[model samples]
Target: MNGKRGMHYVGWKTLCKTKASGGLNFHSAVSRSGPLKARLSWRFLQNKDSLLYQVISAKYGNNLWDATNRRGSSIVSKILLEGAQ
Candidate 1:
């Protein structure tokens, strides 16, 4: 033997299924992030004293919720803005 072990790579769809369905029960990036981003946006709205909220407010202005002017926001900020809506 050349010391090579036989193994098969799992497909993404298989990996993303529930363990009961014979998969690893993993979540894809988009599946995991949408709700999490929305949750973060909600936290920003509800918790003004948090450091994240303070920083976002300062950088994006106090009216970060304004949808009309997202001219130069970062990807994260854009995600937060979309999640808020």
Candidate 2:
């Protein structure tokens, strides 16, 4: 568990032990794997999509952050839209 935005509090997969870990690796881990500090740092931008993300289609861009994080994934996932709400 890490303490990035409260990752230690939220949850993380176990890793590097007698048991296999589900720890996030930069190459494959989801953008949500950002540390709490990163999350908090980038959080202010959540509601408004950044020009770059909007232009390039960043997956963690503002709209996704707001719709996904603001309402929680279950609601977002259930929405079933090609674009996030």
Candidate 3:
């Protein structure tokens, strides 16, 4: 900012480490997405009767949970199944 380029003194992943580990303690969005997707996948498994689950299943078919058949799935379906795998 301020017409200046930021210095690359350390990698972003390193800077995201915990403060106790000598980093800035910032959370990376890339690192956070895995757990979030996994949580959503877990919720989908636990709440099969939910409307979202029902809609997704109806659209994607029962093979939705099948790891090898992700032919033309939507982004949401892909994310959920990826976390499952």
Each model's Cα RMSD: 2.7, 15.0, 4.1
Best of the candidates, lDDT: 3
Ranking by lDDT: 3, 1, 2
1-85, model 2: which lDDT tens digit per residue?
A: 4545653442343332223344543232553434533553344236346553353235434444344344444432223222322
Q: Give the best candidate by TM-score.
A: 1
* lDDT for 10 (candidate 1): 85
The 0-to-1 C-alpha lDDT of every candidate, in the order given, reads 0.80, 0.38, 0.84
lDDT of 2: 0.38
Winner of 1 and 3 under lDDT: 3
TM-score of model 3 relative to the true fold?
Answer: 0.64
lDDT of 1 by residue, 19-80 (tens): 99999988899877878888988987899999987787788786676734767777767878
- Candidates sorted by TM-score, best first: 1, 3, 2
Q: How many collisions between residues are there in candidate 3? A: 0
